[model samples]
Target: MASAAEQLAANMNFGSFQKASELHKRIWFTILAMVVYRLGTYIPIPGINSAAFAQAFGGQSQGILGMFNMFSGGAVERMAIFALNVMPYISASIIVQLMGTVYPPWEKLRKEGGEAGRKTLNQYTRYLTVLLALFQSGSIAMGLQASPGLVDNPGLFFVISTIVALTGGTMFLMWLGEQITSRGVGNGVSLIIFAGIVAGLPRGVWQMFEMTRTGALSAFAMFAIMGIAVAVIFAIVFVERSQRRLLVQYPKRQVGNRMFGGDTSFLPLKINTAGVIPPIFASSLLLLPATVMGFLANANLPAWAQWVPGMVGQLQHGQPAFMVAYGLLIVFFCFFYTSIVFNPDDTAENLRKYGGFLPGIRPGKRTAEYLDYVLTRLTVIGAAYITLVCLLPEALIGFYKAPFYLGGTSILIVVTVTMDTVAQIQSHLLAHQYEGLIKKSKLRGGGRGR
Candidate 1:
């Protein structure tokens, strides 16, 4: 039976792809857009010593900047035009979303003002991104000076040039992401990150092979790393696809002896409601404190300052403390952001207005309470799933010196985005199929009547 079901699925998938010309067009556009994005990553910004910059980055690969570089596809390492990527924009978005929850004015705007408020918020986020880019660019410039040969001019010219270029580059990438979302498949920002991970894969693989060849890494260790990566991916897929289904019942309304409206449906609550945001936010926030401490410690400082870099360095890939903290943060943000995004009260009210009620529950407050209960349980399971997926394999990878892209967050993003895009395609195909059936039915009816 299992083999037969697999065969059936394979056939259905083949048919879907075979006739999905529209889907093909959308996918090709997405690919082209990603290619353009990857190309932009390679275009270096002006006024920096490329060689020294390379060496500095090479030395700092085990630090917080490694995560940033991975996101940017080595753009940050090279100080390319897209060096900043869309991270600052993403950071601004999270900040604005959090503020909208706490501040009454922003909350009102979110609920009532709608599109206009959204536009205002988007503009504000852009301005915030610019500020963040400026700050980052300045810090990077100062860090460059610390490595004596990293800046070609090593003065005002280099600083001004880098600040302008990195800021413009980040803005350009934001625009590109918008274009992809409007004109292509999948999310633009997500696709950009996906492209970076893919581009860096070959290099990562080569480095691992080199380590093995040099006998620094063992054959068993290499096999273990590969096995762990596969397992993590499978775990991510399972958790991401998992959901809780609540049965909703609609009562029959009788008019003129005709019975109607008796139906049942399911409201699916995803296991991982917070998605990739929690881990991404955790990484960004965690990196900030470590980065600042390292910077200050670089100055005329105490012995503790020297220990700071080494401690942070250990935390970068797979140290126990880092893993524990990373997992806990993922779990915290999962619940935190889920609370902000999903409101059971509003949902239950809407269901009541629509004449729908959950099984074994009242229409309003009781239903809301039920939903809240279910969601909380699901969120706990989800947070545990996310934390495990993120931390454990990453710990193992650290044992083997594997790349960060193999971590849980990357797997989550890749799997979630792939699922979403494929679902969109399937919806389009289903709609087309229904339209074709309707047209055939109409033609047969007209012929019979004639």
Candidate 2:
């Protein structure tokens, strides 16, 4: 028999969505926030010579700058105030999370400090973000000054102004993401990144078509690329939804005249527990070093520092070193993040406390070990899948000069974010249906009493 929630979900349709007034408002607010983000991407930082910078960017578009630009929705290409994007925040989050695992105090805060600890950690992340933004923006400012004709008045004033603009832009975006999470549907940070990638999809498609028209990309190759992309998307959806269900059984118990427990359930473990996080983190880590190298290559350096340009070249899209490093990072983060998200020991403890145990496993240490073993195997497969999906774009970009939209990371973000947002909408509709049922039942009961 279907439960009430399941029945409500089954009855959901377009009409139900229409009646979801709160969902509509949230969706509208999300759209408006995205519009604001897009607008900010077009507002260039002060002191940049737009024409000169655009021309210069054209040559470097195939490098790290290009990837960063894609992530920023062309903000980097335009030298906009928001050129830094929320990468600093992401990096800071990575640091904080890592610390939470290794540092005893942080680990205690994470494990037992409750909401207050989480807030404190968030404050720390914000502070770290500001510091990282300052460093990165300063590097970019120096790079801009180094390149002739890129800046209108290359001086300390310009550097200070650029850093202020870029850092402020980043902080504003972080705040905006928080607001969206509180008031809108879906994850605000992921949605911000998703919006950026989606906004550039049309341009990417047009560019691909343009390449085909110019004979740079053959018709057969274009079709093959599209087919591969479709296949990848399908594969992602399948893998993301795949789960390993561990059967758990609770022994029967009785209290007075009532009988309880003896219920069976399945503990579902997702194959890709890390989701799109591994790819995003990998990309951010790789981009940071490449960005610094690219900037330093333009700066006037000592006699021994001339190798910066060579290193930058080697780190460009399609390079063997870059591809290998990217794959490794993806794999590392997959396991690392999965461990952080799901603790087998905690799971075992909770199950034991509730008198629930895996069908064939003991309820304590053995269960924890078994769960860890299974999770490890699943993470291996998950890592391989993510590496393959993410590396395909690098290969295409390196060999065929494919558009950035063809990249697996972008597609993953788009698809995953879409799935999450849709699920949230459905949940909202389900809640609304429950409310309706309760109201109807209340009126009927009141009439009977009368």
Candidate 3:
């Protein structure tokens, strides 16, 4: 059945796309939203010396700061309004999710409140995002002022304005993501981050070509980088689509000479259920402190704050400490976020409710335990895959001086987002085809159609 569906999807042509008017509307809306986001990345903040700010952040581009800038769509380098990006909102959502685990009230709200409850929690996340954005933006404001020539007007007004602009930009991005999720294609937040990382692709490729032309980068090295990129993309495609299918059988039933049930299906569990979230969460969390301290390092401050920047600086890109931390965080979030999103007990209960039973397992407690066991094993492998894929690019950057945007995490995100978005588009096309078939059936019955 899945193969047949895949074949049909592959056969989708221009006519199919033209017929899918609603899908086209969603696609266009998504493109317009993304374009608006890209424009925001170029809009500089008030009272900041663009050239000086660029020099300051540009020097740290090879390290953790570079990764941050990539996610921000080069907003940090320009001191743009969107320099903070959608990170604070993501971080806040992560916090809210973590809280849902430990805090009983929050958990009840998530589990029992339904859509309204989810909306409430989302409201809480937005509020938290505002607070986080304020703190980070303020730190940036203070840092820019302290840095030589970065702030054209270094005073309370400049700091206040910087905080306001940065915070407003983040809020707007949060709203934009919500809009995309509701009325556009793909996940809004993920698409925004994807756009940011990809915006630099053209520039990075150009830089490499320029280097080869200048005899600075050997042709062999550039080709090797391309090879590595292609290999990584292929690996992502293979693993992402890989799934474990558990056979489920339904007992035969008959009523009024009509046979029902007696069919088998597979419950497909994805190898990486967490998607690209773990790396995004881990990187966003790590960057918050690094960004604050990196900026604070140069601030005209007393002796105590000096240690903060020094400690963060030690975890620069290519450092052993950095790799270890990144790997550990990825592993932790992989299991953590996966658990939050998927619950074996719930799945088992639903299966039992519907008279579905996995082969060789009881439908209730045993099924739940078995599902959990399988998920645990799969998650272990998934964590390793994610950690390896994301860290490989970082390692490459550290050793070969590759563009930061080409890192494993960046590539993983790009590939994952691309796959997900394509899947969504295909699903829309499938729905459109289904509608066409239904219309044909109605017309065959000589029914009037609108």
Taking all chains together, each candidate's TM-score versus the true structure is: 0.89, 0.97, 0.95
Number of the predicted model whose TM-score against the real structure is largest: 2
Q: Write the per-residue lDDT of candidate 2 for residues 1-450, one digit (tens) a residue.
A: 877788899999999889889989998999999999999999999999999888888877888778888889999889998898989999999999999999999999998888999999999999999999999999889888988888999999999999999999999999999988989998898998998899899998899889999999998878877887898899999998899999999999999999899999899999999999998898888777777677677667789988988898888888988888889999999999999899999999999999999988988999999999999999999999999988886687567787887788889889988888988888889999998899999999999999
Q: Quick one: ranking by TM-score, best first?
A: 2, 3, 1
Stretches of candidate 1 exceeding 4 Å from the true structure: 1-24, 288-315, 434-450
TM-score-superior candidate, 1 or 3: 3
Summing lDDT over every window of 10 consecutive residues in candidate 3, give the lowest-scoring window: 441-450
Q: Candidate 3's residue-wise lDDT over 159-249, tens digit each?
A: 9999999999999999999999889999999999999999999888888788788887788888987888888899999999999999999
Alpha-carbon lDDT of model 2: 0.90
Q: What is the C-alpha local distance difference test score of each model?
A: 0.77, 0.90, 0.89
